[model samples]
Target: MRTISHGISKIEKGISILLMFSMAIVVTLAVAFRYVLQSPLSWAGEISVFLLIWISFIGGSLGLKYKSQAAVTIVVEYIPENIKRMVMIVGHICMLLFLFILIYYSFTWILSPSVSYQKSTTLLVPMWIPYMAVPLGLTFAAVHLLSNLFDIFQKGESQ
Candidate 1:
């Protein structure tokens, strides 16, 4: 399970890095063209927005893998170990369920007739291309959550 999680995390990280690099280049070109040449790129803004969405989602999944997400551990700190483990498991389960729900609806939304025929104003690409980040990111998060839950069950409160 850890190996699978690691593989997924690796792929997500690689994708995020590439997207970040592309975003930087696109923004730089946009700025250079707008300020220096006085001719703005019509698609730059839209592409940048798409890149940012992907980066945010992928980075969020990485956060789950690294356990770097924001948490209010103040109350948890004083709790008994067994109860704390239970709380953690329950929290992860809740998050997993929520992710699954989001994944299901996102796919439905992406495949709907309205969205299926839609395209971005500047890029003319299918709208679902951008919307895909949601379900994909949520799915990655779900995997990480399951991996964590597995670790908890196997290791017994070591987390």
Candidate 2:
């Protein structure tokens, strides 16, 4: 299980990094073309937006795996060790529930006829392609959350 989780984490990180680099390059080229060459690439803006969407979603999953998301840890720090563990487990469970709900609705929204038929104005790509980031990212986050909850349980058992 850890091996699979680690593999997924590595893939998510790689995709996030790639999307970030691609977004940077696209924006740079867009700027150079519009300002320096006096020719604008209409699709560049749309492509960059798509890349950013993917990056934001995938990066969010990475944050879950690393427990890097922002939190008010002051109160948590003062809690007893066992209480803290309970709190962590409960927190992760709540997050997983939220992610699952979002994932369900996101998929429903993506599969609707209107959304399915729609396409980006500049890129002419299916709108669902970009909108899909929501569910996919949330699914990855759910996996990470489960892994984290498992770790918490394992630690509690060992102690």
Candidate 3:
């Protein structure tokens, strides 16, 4: 289980790094084409926008995996230790529920007629390809949440 979790973390991180690199390359090429060549690549802006969306969603999933999302812990800090555990469990449950909703609706949206009908203006690529990030990211987040919950429960049982 530990190995599987670590492997997923590595895969997520690798994809995130690739997304970042792709964004940088796209922007750099767009700028260079516009300024140096005096003619911008027609697809550059559209493609960059699509890639940026992918990057944001994928990075967000990795953030959840690492528990890197921003939080206000002031209230939790003031709570008694016993209550803090309950609060944390509740928080995890809420996150799990939110991700479940995201996964379901995103899958539905991906299969909807609108996504199938739409295409990128320049590339003519089906919009669903880009829209796929929604479900994929949510699935990653769900896995991370479940793994954390399992670990928490295991620790409790051991204690």
Candidate 4:
């Protein structure tokens, strides 16, 4: 289980790095075209927007895996140990539910004919391609949540 989790983490990190690099390249080209050539790349804005969507979704999933999502822990810390455990369990369950909903809707959204029918006005790429990141990220987050829940149960059993 540890190995599987580690592998997923590594893959997520690698994809994130690639997305960052792609965004950097797009920004560089956009700037060069607008300033150096005195003409903006018409497609740059559309491409950047699409890349931003992908980055945001994937980054969110990575955050879940790392438990890096922003949260105020002071309230939880003040709670009694047993209550805190219950709160943690409930929170994880909520996250799992949220992820599952996201995955389902995102998949349906991506599969809708409207997605394939539309193209970016400037980039001329199918909208579905960028929209795919939604389901992909949600799936990753759901997997991480389930894994964490399993770990929690295992620890409880041991105690």
Q: State the lDDT of candidate 1 residue by residue for 1-159, as single tens digits.
A: 788889999999899989999999999999999999999999999999999999999899999998999999998899998888889899999999999999999989988999999999988999999989998998898898899989888878355
- lDDT scores in order: 0.92, 0.90, 0.85, 0.84
lDDT of 4 at 68: 94
Name the better of 2 and 3 by TM-score: 2
Q: RMSD of model 4, in Å?
A: 1.5
Ranking by lDDT: 1, 2, 3, 4
Q: What is the C-alpha RMSD of each candidate to the true structure, in Å?
A: 1.5, 0.9, 1.5, 1.5
TM-scores for every candidate against the unseen true structure: 0.96, 0.96, 0.92, 0.92
Assess candidate 1 and give its TM-score to the true structure.
0.96
Q: Which residue window of length 10 is worst by lDDT in model 2? A: 1-10
Q: How much does candidate 2 score in TM-score?
A: 0.96
lDDT of candidate 2? 0.90
lDDT digits (tens) for residues 71-153 of candidate 4 = 99999999997787788899999988887887888898999888879897876888888889889888887877777777777
Clash number for every model?
Answer: 0, 0, 0, 0
Worst 10 residues of 4 by lDDT: 1-10
Q: Candidate 1, clashing residue pairs?
A: none
Q: Which stretches of candidate 3 lie over 4 Å from their true place?
A: 1-3
Compose the digit string of candidate 3's lDDT tens values, residues 16-131.
78878888998999999999999999998888888888888878877877789999999999998768777878889998998898899999999999889999899999999989
